[model samples]
Each structure stands twice: as structure tokens, then as C-alpha cells.
Target: MRLSVLGAGAIGPAAAALAASRGHEAVLWSPSGRGTMGLDGRIAAEGALSGVFPLRVAQGLEEALASADAVLLAVPAYAFPALLPRIAQAMPAGLPLLIAPAASLAPLAFEALRAGLGPRAPVGALATTPLTARRLAPDRVRIPAIRAAVDVAAVPAAATPEIATLATALFGHACPAAPDVLQPALANANPIIHAALALTNATRIERGEAWPQYELMTEATCRLMSALEAERAALAAALGYVVPTLAEALHRASGVPQGRLAAMGAAIAASGRAVLGPAEMETRYVTEDVPYGLSFYLWLAAGRGVAMPRTAATVAVLEVLWGRDLRANPLLEALDAAGLPRLLREGIGR
Candidate 1:
């Protein structure tokens, strides 16, 4: 299969290498073009799979989009709005476009793509990122773990089985089908883990303490994360899905032992895949996950009259600490149950 990997982050290089190892062709592209530099059309990979993979870097986004059997957007959630449009304009009709680690990103992309491409275009989301990797260099990545199974959902929901089959074939693993986009979005584990880590260790991040994030997690931090997870689970339950808690999610994805939150954190630390924590509060934990993940959860809770005091409190504190309003995505604010399913199935109807 010829796949186009959009974005040049750790996941992109690692995924490209994995594809090549499976005898599939992959072309990587960076939206900013800066990420493509230092890539001499090859990948030096270590960790889960070690090798020097011969990779092909696309000269431009259009070039990459035009020459692919499928597309994978392995970028940050914030980049979705800007790049999805360009992708819609150039993507071949009927091509499958996947958003890795969907986490509420699928709806936005689905709406954006269908506005121009219509309802038949295959746009879906992965429940979580396919792999955990660290970039050693521009063209080198260290992949510590590949997820055991990734839940996937498509816009029409009927297309899920087909997309799941395709994903399984492409990744050489199980790709389960999610009931809806929201199921995968709420099931995301990053916001729950990242929020607790960043807030509890704000002082450490400020001091530039380079510690393993998962290894050093305290009982207090775990307790707080559990509180947030409870609220998230409540929201998911209200929405009709029995979502897994943070600890369960960790165990399922990385083989972290399930017990108390602290025990899970310790296991994650010893997993050899644990990476260093953020140096400051300005990192994605507070910025991206808070807004896209936790904040979105709070917003949903509020409408349902569900009490999410702990989740709300964390966001409030982070807002003052970061000196920015956390719940500020206009698109999300505009969403409600009455129009949500329609928007998910059809385009924005513009």
C-alpha cells in the first residue's frame, strides 16, 4: 500500500519506518516544511523496531496528497483546522483519511472535509496514537510502544467496519470499530494523564527538573487523576458508552499494570518507554489537552448538569496559572446534542 503520512513529528517518522518494514510504501510530508528538513529520505529508528529505513519525503503537501492510497494525519490537534482544508482540496476522491489519536478531532475534520468533498469521502479517527515515539533527530525516532488495538470510527458509522479492516491491514494489528466519533474522543487517555502530571508538577516543570513523568508520580497526583477520570467516565456514561478510566487506558495501551493510580504510574515509569516530563506549563499538557480534551469534557458535563468539580477546578487553576482562558474553542462552544449527530453525519451544511 502507498500511504501518505502527514506531519513530520515523532509519530510520522516512526510510522513511515513501520510501513516500510511491512513492505508498504510511505511518503511523509510536513505542513510547515520545517519538519521535512534534515530528512535525507531515510529514517534511523530504534526501540521497538530498529533499523535504517529508506523513506521518501514529499516535496509538497499536494504532491503527497495526490500520490497516496490513504492518508494519515499524525499531527497535533491544533493543526487540524488549517491543514484539513488544504487536504480536502487536494485529496483524491474516495481516499481514506485518518486522524491519529482522534480525541474529538474527527468531528471537526469530518465536517470540514464533507463541506467540499461530500459525505462519501472516508474520514475517520483513531482512538489513540498508533505508537509512542521520541525523535532522536529530524530523521530518527525511538518507538517504545505500539498500541495493542486502536478504536476507529467513521462519519456515517456504517463505514467503520471497512475502515477498521483497512487500518488493520495497514498497521498489521487490530483496529476495532467505535460506535461513534465521540466514543473514541472521550476514550482518549492523554488529557487525563497529562493534566494531572502537569498541574501536580508545575513547580518541577518551572524549575526545569528533568524527571521521568510516569516514574515519579505521587499518590496525590494519582488521586487527582482518578477524580478527573471519574468525571470523564460519568460524561461518557451519560453519552451511552462505558469508557475506560485513565488507569485502564494506560494498561490497555502500554501494558502498565492496573492497580492504584500511583501503582500504574510507577509501572509506566519502569516500562522503559516513559519519557521526560515537560519543562514548563506552556507545553501541550496544559495547552492542547486541557483545551481539546479536559475542557471539552467540562463543556459536555455542564450541558448535562453533571457535576465535574474536580475537572472544573483543575481547569480553573490552570487558567490562572497559565494566564489564559482554557475553555475557548468557539466551535466546541457552538456544539449541542440537537445538531451534533447531524453535523457528524453530514457537513456543517454551509
Candidate 2:
């Protein structure tokens, strides 16, 4: 299989490298062209996956999509609105498109656009990324761990098996099917975890001080996370979907024991796998997760007549701190909240 990976960030390179290691011909394209610069068409991976693999760098989107059997989007959640439309326009009909760590109902947004865009492709979403990694340099990445199983779902639920097979083939890991896109979208725990960390440690982030993110997951912060989690679970239940708890998700993803939230944090810290917190206040933890993740949750809650006081309060505080209306998401604005539950389960036209 030939894979075309979009985005050139840590996840993109790590994904391309993993695909190459599996004997699939992989090509990478960075929209800015800077991520692939100095790489000379090669990628070096360390830690969980160690290898020097040959890579092909595409000069443009068309070049990347050409001759590719499947397309994997590894970009951040904030990039979805602009990037998805362009990809829909350029991609060939019937090519499978997969979004890893899909959040904020991105797959539904893409499906809504594709109805008029004329593409017949099936769009799939992953609950979280398959690999935990970071960019070490322009051409290198550090992969800390590869997940054992990743939850997946497709827009037109029936296409799930095909997407799951493609995902498992590309990553050499299990890609379990979810009932619908809602299952995977609501299953993501990053927004809740990051919100607590950023709000409690705002001063440290604003000061640009280096700190271990998990080490600072004090009892109070964990309590806040639990409160947020309860709200999220309530929203999911209201929608008739039962998703995993934060503790269950962490245990599945990182081998953290399923116990109290603070104990899980302590175990992660003791294991020496905890990464550093953001050095600055303007990071995906606040920017991407707040508007796209938490705010989206609030939107769903409003449609379901469910109260999410803690979740709403978190969004309000972050908006004040950032001095901007973070909930002004284009995708959420375009959606019909009253009809979204059915739409998410039944795709664009039902």
C-alpha cells in the first residue's frame, strides 16, 4: 500500500516512519514545505520504533495524493476546517481518508462538506493517535510508545471495517470499531486533562518556566479533572453512548493503572515517561483543546439540555485568560444542534 500523510508535525513524521517500517511506500507533505526541508527524503525514528527509513517528500498536495491508496491526516484539531475542504477538493473519488486523534466532531464536519464537494470517499476518525511522539529535529522523531488499540469509526458507519483494516495495516496495531463517530469523538480525554493542567498552572506557563506536566497533577487538580469527567460522561449518556472514563482510557493508552486519577499521575511520574508542560501560555493545550474540544462539549450539552457547570466554567475562565471568544468555532456554528445527534449516527444525508 502507498500512503500519503498530511501535516509535517511530530505525528506526521512518526506516522510516515511507521508506515515505511511496515513495508508500505509512504510519502509526506508539509503544507508550508518547511517540515520536510533538510530531510533529504529520509526519516530517523528513535525509542519505541527505531529505524532509518526512506521517505518521499511531495512538493504539493496533488503530488502527495497522487498514486496513494490511502490518506492520513496528522494535523492538529485547529487545522481541520481549512485543511479538510482543500483535501476534499483535491483527493480522488473513493480514496479512504483517516484522521488520527480526531476531536471536535471533525469527521462529521468533513462529511458535511463532502456531500457538496462531490467526493465519494469514506472518512474515518480515531479516538487518539496511535503513537506518542515528538519531533527531535527537522528529519527525526522520538516515539515514546505505540498504543495497543485505537478506537475507530467512519462517517457512514458501515465503512468502519474497511477503515479499521486500513488503519491496522498502516500502524500494525489494533483498530477496534466504535458504534459511530460520536463514540470516538467523545472518547478523547486530552481536552479535559490539558484544561486542568493549564488552568491550574497558568502562572507557570505564562512565566515560561519548565515543569513536568504530570508531576503537577496534584489532588486538587485531579479532583477538578474528575468533576470535568463526570460532566463529559453525563453528556455522552444523554446522547445514548457509553464511552470510557479517563482512568480507563489512560490505562489502555499508557499502561497507567486504573485507580484514582492522582495515583495514576503519580505512577506516570514515577515511571519517568512524563513530558514537560508547555513553556508558554499559547499552546494546543489551551488554544486547540479549549475552543475545539471543551467548547464543543458545551455546545452538545446545550442541545441535550444537560448542564455542564464545571466544563462551562473551565471554558469561561480560559476565554477570560486569553481575552478572546474561544467558542467561535466555524464547524460548531454551521451545525444544527437539534439535528446533530441523528446526523452523527447516520452520516450526512441519513
Every candidate's lDDT: 0.78, 0.86
The candidate 1 region of ten consecutive residues with least summed lDDT is: 329-338
Residues 1-350 of candidate 1: C-alpha lDDT, one tens digit per residue: 89899989888878888888888888999888888899997999898789998888998888897758888888877666566668777777677888887755455654655565444565677877777788888888998877777778876666778778777777765776777677788888899888888888888887988978888679988888888888888888887777767766777667867788788777777767788988876688887788888888877776677889999899999888788888875446435555666665544543
Q: What's the TM for model 2?
A: 0.95
Q: After superposition, how far is residue 256 of candidate 1 from its true place, in Å?
A: 3.3
C-alpha-based local distance difference test score of model 1: 0.78
Residue 162 error for model 2, in Å?
A: 1.4
Residue 261, model 1: Cα distance from true site in angstroms: 2.3
TM-score of each: 0.94, 0.95
> For candidate 2, which ten residues in a row score worst on lDDT?
112-121
